[model samples]
Target: MKIFENCHLFHYPFEKVSAAHWQKYPNEYATHVVAVDTLDRKVLPDSQTLYTERLITCRQGVPRWILKLVDGAQECYIREVSYMDLKSRTLTLLSSNMTFCDRLRVHETVTYSPHHELNATVFRQEARIEALACMKRLANIVEQWSVDRISQKASIGKLGFENVLKQINLSVFHQLPVPSPDANS
Candidate 1:
């Protein structure tokens, strides 16, 4: 699994602009803007704007999707936005798939003071790794169960215990095996 990190500069219009103007540069004026973050705060090449009227409503509402892909072949999908607080400068994001039940959660805070410099690079790195791990585990489980079920059904000529096991393995569940007293003894 590979984690792709994207930093966006979200711009909300303080005042309304003409529909024609917006249409001309819809990507520029839309609230859900995406731009790659540089060490010097410059936008990256090939990054484009996404204008989703359904997801964004000017400056007053949260967009349905906060991140968009600018590059890469990763199929990573965002599961949920756990929390976002500007006053506290904290954000949490989680991602998971149903196959392997792999899940990743990330918590990060940003602070800026007149006397110090703030950096978000480390936090971004950590969050990307966590997300990738979750995706990888889930994908692996899904792939394995698919292969097993196909083979088992072909060989056994029936969908029974093996099929059930395959279904359980693909679900988001955890089970603990317990030992009987006699067996333990």
Candidate 2:
């Protein structure tokens, strides 16, 4: 088993970052992310939190050596669940691999919140990788490879999200004018 953790600061407000996260897919930098399907979404009874569950399909090619072990599968499926709390200005995401259950598994947690002493948002990510005991000789190699791949993806993913934030005017989320009740009359 191997653990990887990283933290970064986005020079944007928490609200902006949180809103952009939903629209991050289809960005050029994250082309590996092929599809995103929302399985479920709901606002909690508290009225301050929104919960979402999604399945993400990623088109990734692994090393040839690893391919032989997993029967040449090139697509990865991930199950992601997220919680966004409006009152706390925080967004938390939990994601895990759904493919190759017998060979390996990667579970990740990511959070976005306001910085303590700055006007920016803080992004933190942690991934736990486990190579199943079945691959006694290749376990170490698999774990290390997963860590490296995840690190690279993290950088690209951040860049993609930054682009998303730039293209969308986040303030518009709150600034949209409400139509008059009698406008249709």
Best by lDDT: 2
Candidate 2 deviation (Cα RMSD): 5.1
lDDT of 1: 0.28
Candidate 1 clash pair list = none
lDDT of 1 by residue, 69-162 (tens): 1122222222222233233333333323222124433222221111114221112211222333435645444344334432432234222323
Question: What TM-score quantifies how close candidate 1 is to the native fold?
Answer: 0.21
Residue-pair clash count for candidate 1: 0
Give the Å shift of residue 48 in candidate 2. 1.9
**Which window of ten consecutive residues has the lowest lDDT sum in model 1?**
12-21
Off by over 4 Å in 1: 13-81, 100-185
Q: Model 2, 17: alpha-carbon shift in Å?
A: 0.5
lDDT of 2: 0.91
Give one digit per residue, the lDDT tens place, for model 2 in 87-125: 888999999999886899999999999998998999999
- TM-scores of all predicted structures: 0.21, 0.89
